[model samples]
Target: MSVIEEERVRGGVFKDINPEDEDQQPTVIESLCMNCYENGSTRLLFTKIPFFKEIIISSFTCPHCNWTNTEIQSAGRIQEQGVLYTLQVKTKEDMNREVVKSDSASTRIPQLDFEIPAFTQKGSLSTIEGLLDRAVAGLEQDQPIRKATDPAVAEKIEEFIERLKKLKKVEEEFTLIIDDPSGNSFIENPSAPQKDTALTVTHYKRTPEHNAVLGIETEEEEDDRKPVNDLDTMRNEVLVFNTNCPECNAPANTNMKLVQIPHFKEVIIMATNCDSCRHRTNEVKSGGATEELGTRITLHLTDPSDMSRDLLKSETCSVLIPELEFELGMAALGGKFTTLEGLLKDIKDLIVSKNPFMCGDSSTADRAGKLELFGQKIDKIIAGEMDVHVILDDPAGNSYLQNVYAPDPDPEMKIEKYTRTFEQNEDLGLNDMKTEGYAEK
Candidate 1:
């Protein structure tokens, strides 16, 4: 048998076995060394991280030249959107946070104005300190040659390298940002299952230019090649399309349907399920154009039956609870069509369970107590044991709370319409949009 086959057989890395299985062992294979032009050994391991995605780690060692290289690659499909992670490094403990830097990801330190552009270095699974060490090593590697060629430039680079090294000590605060168009990179959240206050993770729709760089076709490009179909005519009919699962990145089908509420307008609901990971997600979106005036819906929860009221919160809607002094901004939970109780439960889960510093060793007794108390208040409100006002503010005026009295206005419910502010219009990208005279321009 060949060396690769023999190694696979000996390591028990079989095709029938799941590559992402935790029990799987690394497989060794012979390869050519680029530096020495000699045979080398490459060890490849496929593993899945807990609460994360699958990845492949490969390390190559040259026996003749004593050269070694390591790399990591995501074993999942590219995400539909790009991800930007902003981390606040304030303490030395922050240096221990794990980071998965993809080859397509760019790293930036805002304080030093230092950036490592995408494709400049191979992808690696390392901690923050490890990344800084690698950067220092890389800079030092070429310093001798630079010093002989240009002394002045070498001195500046040496100073910069020192600054990079000092970041590990975290003597001063710095912001580390990772922008990945492929969205496969990740920074470990020590507060798993909770929101990390110091770490902000934002997933944005990839721009056309970003998609082009990633070799992904834009929606406009795909529309040009395919015939356009009227979605309005297919209302009530479930449309199925193929997409990658957000959780596992496996191939899956998304089902979409347009449903018109009795008094409200049309809305589209989309659902996706992945068989490989058994992950499921559903989202709701407004099907109509932006309204001329923004809408604000307020409901007073006094009776237990108020929890049964159906509510539709658009992606552009912000939620506010006066009693709890809690305010959730738009896009926090995406669009959801659920009952009052369901919505409150989701909010409670988001604030209580997803809080990074609420339950872990990094948490303090005082802070954890406050969050725990806040969660109990939400439960009381949901149980109708407490009287509170729930407000829904939608800049696009697409959100709605079902009126118990259909023909007549409910006494406890209030609906107000007002002109959207310039900032709100700007947030919705309406300020830059020209409805007319665009062709002349």
Candidate 2:
């Protein structure tokens, strides 16, 4: 076995081993069976799932009582973000789709108002139908005792189990959701390289409660635990801190610095590098307070040389290109401080290469063609071959674009300030904010 495989064995789980090797069989040890209180043999097998991560499967069998139990656990590290998978089951074929539910994941059926809470059951690698079968088995397991004691409750549970069984028939449409704070669960996408229309996967940042449950500390918590001295002296220095790689979940270092733009306000730039995964990412954040009014900047691109202008797109900023009929929403790309050309390239990459459905077998010709054309137009804009107007709308009034004529107003660039609408303020979470008189209330 390789060193990596050996490490896995040391962690109480075996790595992938050749089945033909006589000495490389799965490790088996005597374990106490919970049901029979008898000695049982537990077999541990660690293997990789195709297109997924490593997992450990353990099976315990008590020969005396003929008791058996199987469970799966993810051998991979926790992910940087939580995942929510929504799969629509409309046909019998949908029941055959593969599903991997980690111990930290919760399963829900909206149509039936049923839920399996996290940590309530062991992790399993099964199909949709298999999940429903397990639910029915669990419900039926205690039905006999319940029927003898409480017939009323037993009748309701039996009726529910029948409804669950009916779901396997696909007589009605239903939605299955798997929400995993550890991001270890998965629902197979039947479309493969293409996007599955019936499946919607969303990744979100874990909340503080989730972090507490995971035993992960946030930067804020670290700061409170260890107070830094001389904040003024640290303003100009690059601050380095420990973090985990988002890609591989390995220990990494994040460097942050306060940078001041010559004509604009100060911003905090943070960059992280992972030695294990060789992954690097940098982002910018506005350091100043939100302005009283929103700012809209429009620049007409006429010369190719205009691509070199520096642009700071705040997290609250949206980008619009009227000629290309492209509108990017706020916080879509996070905060970025780069040249105009670089920003446009990033936008093209996001819409084309990074799009989940852009290059799959299920991608329609018309849809793909339009995205390709959109990419080409961006390239033209970057090369100065196309004349168009680019607008930066920031409701927080934090975005900035370089003015070629410093101190003097550029004729091609127009800047406008306007009061933000009530909806915009609400979206920014400013509607409920009480800056003063909070103690009085």
Candidate 3:
């Protein structure tokens, strides 16, 4: 029998399994090391995870090359649909709550402009404060930040780190959002001081790419599966044939996949990395069909939770934030898939980038003063100290402002559908369709 089979049959590796759960035992699977291709050099340890049922913790290490990897996999036949866990962390006690985050989970703290992307680490079992600490450590260890020589940039990073530490200590309040497409992550509800009041858990459907990552294959689907980030998955099964880099005409690799917005329809996000020129570009395309009537959406950001709402803007959508004195025409921004606060920060960055002279360049003294004041107001709005209105106007009516629960409309939001003006039609190159009696010859 192979070593793995022996480990499965004679399970004595975890003799000290928690006394309360004596029946549980760890299984070891020995396989070839990925790094060195040495037989029996990789040992995968499988053990039952506490607090959650039908779940097993899997960790592997290669003695040959010191390679290590860990993952949380389900042992039972039943798998919950994708899930999102949102907790309003108010006090230091709230940060002490236990969290079981899967490797597939992506965490976001909107107010902090912080996100810990999926697959960045093997699953982590930590407290809310510990999670924030991980995010801080990641930022500090990031190559770009560590190697940056600009004093101003370094100062800003330090300030951001201090703010995050404050959040960890619960001196400031922010929403903690964890989205697990695999539905394997959880926040401890049993320890909540009040029944169902500390956190909100919502179940959602898994995307095709998500299911592929978890190896949840359906019998009806094709036997061959592509990687989750493959171009075929990004275009929703429509294969993109182009393989050459657009910038240098060199062979390049592309990864594209569809990601579902919480309160909106799915969007195809495509990214290409060029090895020749080291160029990278990302683009977003809507999954839904266009509408004849132009639509307008207005959202009131009166509460902190509103900042967490997802925003999807088509290329033809115009964005306006009156309080910040910001306006972007349809042609200004190509497209966007970001949260409300993220969108605002993007605009702030655009302003800074476009008007470099206004950032205390001394040559534009008056403009710098005005721009500085404008930037302060935007900062205030993002901090949730100032209430503002966000408006999205789409000539093609393809844009969307996320509702609280998708598919179920948000009655609190104001939406208006209007007839497209002549200019609007011209902008879309539809003026030829309006030439009264024109027909193909």
Per-residue lDDT over 242-313 for candidate 3, one digit per residue giving the tens place of the 0 to 100 score: 565543335667776677776556787777787655767665788776677999999877777787887888
lDDT tens digits by residue: candidate 1, 193-243: 334678877766778888778777656433445543876666847989998
| Candidate 3, run of 10 with poorest lDDT | 354-363
User: In model 1, which regions exceed 4 Å deviation?
Assistant: 1-24, 32-43, 47-52, 59-70, 87-100, 124-130, 186-203, 218-233, 242-252, 273-279, 293-304, 318-329, 344-393, 405-427, 439-441
Q: Show where candidate 2 strays beyond 4 Å.
A: 1-207, 217-235, 249-251, 274-277, 322-325, 358-370, 418-441
**Candidate 3 residue 401 C-alpha distance from true site, Å:** 1.1
Q: Which candidate is the best by lDDT?
A: 2
Q: What TM-score would every model get versus the actual structure? A: 0.72, 0.60, 0.42
Candidate numbers, best TM-score first, in rank order: 1, 2, 3
Over the full model, what C-alpha lDDT does candidate 1 score relative to the true structure?
0.81
Please report the TM-score between candidate 2 and the true structure: 0.60
Candidate 3 deviant stretches above 4 angstroms:
1-252, 258-266, 274-280, 354-356, 359-363, 405-412, 434-441
Q: Over all chains combined, what TM-score does candidate 1 have?
A: 0.72
Per-residue accuracy of model 2 over 1-441 as CA lDDT, tens digit each:
665445653433333334554655566999999998989999987665532467778999999999999999876778767888899999998998878899988999998899999888999978899999998999999999999999999999998998998888998899999999998887866553234689877666789988888778776533445665765665779999998665455667999988889888889889999876477888889989999999999999999989999999987898989887677767457789999998998998877766534543335686678778888888898888999999999999999999999989999999999999997887677898889876855
- Please tell me which model should have the higher lDDT, number 2 or number 3: 2
Candidate 2: lDDT of 317?
Answer: 93
